[model samples]
Target: MLQMDPMRPLDPALPITPQLTQRLRDRIIRNHLKPGDRISETEIAKVYDVSRQPVREAFIKLADQGLLLIRPQRRTVVSRIAYQDVLDARFLREAIEADIVRLLAKTRDDALIGTLRAQIELQKRVHADDLETFTQLDEQFHRMLADAVGKAGTWSFVEGVKAQMDRVRFLSLFDYPMALLIEQHTQIVDAVEARDLDRAEENARQHLRLMLDYLPGVIAANPSFFDLPEGGLAPSVNTPTLGGEYT
Candidate 1:
């Protein structure tokens, strides 16, 4: 099961369509709803206690993100993992972050250094069972590195394109050892502290490639979560069954 559940009531913060989109997106990325798993609008609408209109809207949105596949006269299924998309995201991220780390290494800001070390400490301290928290902290550490080099904008852009890779990361989390991630993070920090741009760049590249290394085995193990390209179909709005709807 995903650590988070989508069936809960909608958060008050967002509009209905986006709210539903996020819940479904989280589930798909987190592998709570594995790829290739059929998702019935009727069932989801009933489970979330929402009208079919919002759920259908959310379906189109997720399909746009390459997370869901909508087919006419067939069941809606999760999109299969697209390795090409994964590679593209990683490539863009490396191009952006490789420079971020290089620049961050050239400067020696004590406060930033302290922050990097503190984040690494937090990474090490994160319990093995809490993979989700560790993943978030990992993102923060990279964001901090980007901000240090005034490349926050670059990081934002990389994040915007990493939706597919994010799912691969979540899938690979349990399949591979987390210790390697912690160790890699530590090495990256060590290189930064030493002001070694060459080493830092290499470490960043290697760290980003880590997911790619671990993903094949996971995909093989969870073969059902993927599909080849296909056509799409949109459904007309209708009232939902089982009557309750969450945002």
Candidate 2:
């Protein structure tokens, strides 16, 4: 029952493993590969007319990102989102971005404000149903702030740690208010432009904390997609029923 959209032929000239890794990551994040769905290295290899070696490499990379579960002598499956992982990622993001906005406010960069304003306009133009495009724009908006402060590498590190958070976000995109999100983006930009460091930092922190407010509802609506206990905490990793056993 696993269905994937048609993928373009792998470029013969470029390295294959990273390409496969990114493509497979996209499929996983977009829900094309649901949690607990079994996947075959051989099938994916054949899909791109490649050998299994690169496919295996891609699987291992994704497993490291907590997006894929690789079991020895068994099928590889998409991982259910770990509640702790999402919380930890949001914590890290808020810590970094809140400071980034405050720094921007201190500097009061006109060009940066202009760039963010343009980005906000682009976000508003995305149709409400076009969650994928809005998500991309949202990332771009944040990355622009980081880039303004020479923290692009830091942003990359955050990106590496946020796969689980991104999965939950993609799930909630349909119902989450895109307009409110855009407003938050505007608030941060406005605070920075006004050179109010305290207000900018607070706005950034509040914006990032929206995930905490939204996560419980997302989990309630899609209980099967997460690995959470009755108390709403992440279960120990060694839990046999959800961990060792592959359903």
Find the candidate with the highest lDDT and give its number: 2
Clashes of each: 7, 0
Clash count in backbone of candidate 2: 0
Off by over 4 Å in 1: 1-7, 40-42, 49-54, 72-74, 227-247
Could you estimate the TM-score for every candidate? 0.78, 0.90
Q: C-alpha displacement of 101 in model 1, angstroms?
A: 0.8
lDDT of 1 by residue, 1-247 (tens): 2233543787656678888888888788887887777888788877776789998999988888789899977889888877667767877787677778888789967788888888888988889999999999999999998888888888877866787889888877776577888888888888888999878877887787776666667667766654423442112121121133311
Which candidate ranks first by TM-score, i.e. highest? Answer: 2
Where does candidate 1 have its weakest 10-residue lDDT segment? 233-242
**Residue-level lDDT for 167 in candidate 2:** 90
lDDT for model 1, please: 0.77
Query: In candidate 2, which residue pairs clash?
Result: none
